[model samples]
Target: MSRVQCPRCLRPKTHCLCPLIPRLDSRTRILLLQHPSEVNHALNTARLAALGLNNAELIVGEVFDDLPKLLNCPGYQARLLFPAEDAQPLQAYSSAPDEQPLLLVVPDGTWRKARKLLHLNPLLAALPRVTLAAGAVSRYRLRKAPGPGALSTVEAIVQALQTLEAPTSFEPLLKPFEALIDGQIEAMGEEVFQRNHGEGKA
Candidate 1:
């Protein structure tokens, strides 16, 4: 029989990560546009990110028909968190006292899937884009990263939040993610993990 799953975190009941998931508030609102294909991913970090942040929303789809309303959130300026040739570095952005906080729109999927999202939603692609600083590595040891400086969805959100809201650590948001990684490693056995991902187990 299939193991029972937690209704919230969607993990098998025995490995449920609900307790480690944090409920934190942030000034910048986050809107995650996740591809449908990623919903059942073992980690599903985008869902974790949405659950942990008070001011966040996750919408799963390829074409978002309500882009106008979603992008026009009051008191917030929407910025797409995606890389581009002319992407603005998030570190250089700061809200003035009179300015609105950011509504960071993140796409959750593999690079190809994410790009497909942009292709399907022209307005989403047209938004001003922002990117994280280079050299930050991902802690997702189970999967080979597509490239250097790659990060999981939750990790990217944490780094983006930390940069946008400096001096206020968003580290607690990573508790569930770390637990998930540890659990996966343990399940796969140390020898197998060491053989595959031990080189950069950060």
Candidate 2:
């Protein structure tokens, strides 16, 4: 028989990070666009980000036909969280209190797949892009990144929300994420895992 999974975090009962999930009420909302294939990936951080933030929406698809409706959602400024060379630093728009509250659209997938998301959705491509703070690094030890300066979806969302909304509201969202990574490393139960993910580790 299969082990029971937590309906919320979708992890096995012993591995569920739901208890540590924060109920963050961020003024800036999150709209995550996930590749259909990544919905069941064990290390998915997009779901965690949505689960933690009260104002988050998770949409799964490679090509979206209803994106127009999403883009036109009232009272929210739609922006893509992509790291294109010309992307504006997120803080530039965030520090302004007069700007519309953000609806941050993030893609969840490998680098190639993420790029495909941009390519497949012109609406997503045309949206203004926002990049994270300089020197920001991902603490997601569970998965190998596709390239340098890559951050998991949750990490990026957490960092972005910190700038876009009240700092205190988004900081706690990472606690469950850290716990998830630590729990997975502990389960690995090998010297290689222990030595690599030590103190001061990324």
Candidate 3:
């Protein structure tokens, strides 16, 4: 028999992470575009991010037909959170209280899938790009990072929010993400986790 799942958080009833998800408000709006394939993945961090932030939205699809409405949020300058040669560093907005808060458009998928998202949505690609500063680390231990600054969807959102809104910590948003990781580790058993992905392993 299948286990029941929480209406929110979507974790199995026995391991529900709803209690840890926060409903924090942010000046900057977040729009997470997730590939359909990622919806049912065991670690659907994008859903966690959407639930935790009052100003965020999560949409699942390969091609977004409503890019016009999605990117046209008033009082917020829309910026794609993807690295590019000319992308502006996110830290630039940290201290700019006079400037408009961003409508951060993030693609939640693997490297290739995220690229596909940008490819499919020209308007999404046309938005000015913003990137996190270098040397940031990922807290997700279960999977190999695709690159140096790779982070899970929730982690990336937290980092971006914290950077764009300095002094207003968004660390609380990560509570459920951390819990989910711990649960995965516990389920894997210490011996297997240590042998495969423990300290200095992956």
Candidate 4:
């Protein structure tokens, strides 16, 4: 077997191309609170999103030890990116005045882990929640969701940025994410095809 490492996430480097990632800049700042476990996983989209956006920050941890400082960033309005039964929709938060729209707080992890973060962090729960109305299919083929339209962190951010009418720079950043997912799907399909066809030397 070939010993390849995933370029983007730096895992065994196999089946991952996150390293060829592109950079992006946007008017709105994104703050991703990622779980430690998710950081080590090969399918982490938060890392890709952070790499694409210049104004985005990805912090790996279970708790926001520096919550006070983050909340104090000047001219920034912080809102949690989540789907709560009682939370306001993402469109509502995106429509807020741009003059005070600097920060967006997102929890990066699986549904279970993300929920745990919300339950454990009362401060995060107190923050306003933003739920997205995304129409695009998820790019993460390696990961499964409880339901349809559950997107990777990067896709969710892209949808949110579009809704918020963020700068044009944000659109291009989504390209690499699309590329990475397509690459993975293509590679996997080739492997399956070859296996089924018995093209390899017997």
**Top of the candidates by lDDT:** 1
Clashes of each: 0, 0, 0, 8
Comparison by TM-score, 1 against 4, better one: 1
Candidate 2 worst ten-residue window by lDDT:
90-99
Q: Residue 127 CA error for candidate 3 (Å)?
A: 1.1
lDDT tens digits, residue span 87-182, model 3: 998873645556888899999998899999999999998999998888989999888787899999898889898887777899998899889889
Sorted on lDDT, highest at the top, how do the candidates line up? 1, 3, 2, 4
Q: All models: lDDT?
A: 0.93, 0.83, 0.90, 0.73
User: In model 1, what lDDT does residue 128 have?
Assistant: 96
lDDT of 2 at 135: 79
Model 2 stretches with alpha carbons more than 4 Å out: 92-98, 143-148, 195-202
Give stretches of model 3 more than 4 Å off.
Answer: 92-98
lDDT of 4 by residue, 121-140 (tens): 78887887777884667755
Residue 45 error, candidate 1, Å = 0.3
lDDT of 4: 0.73
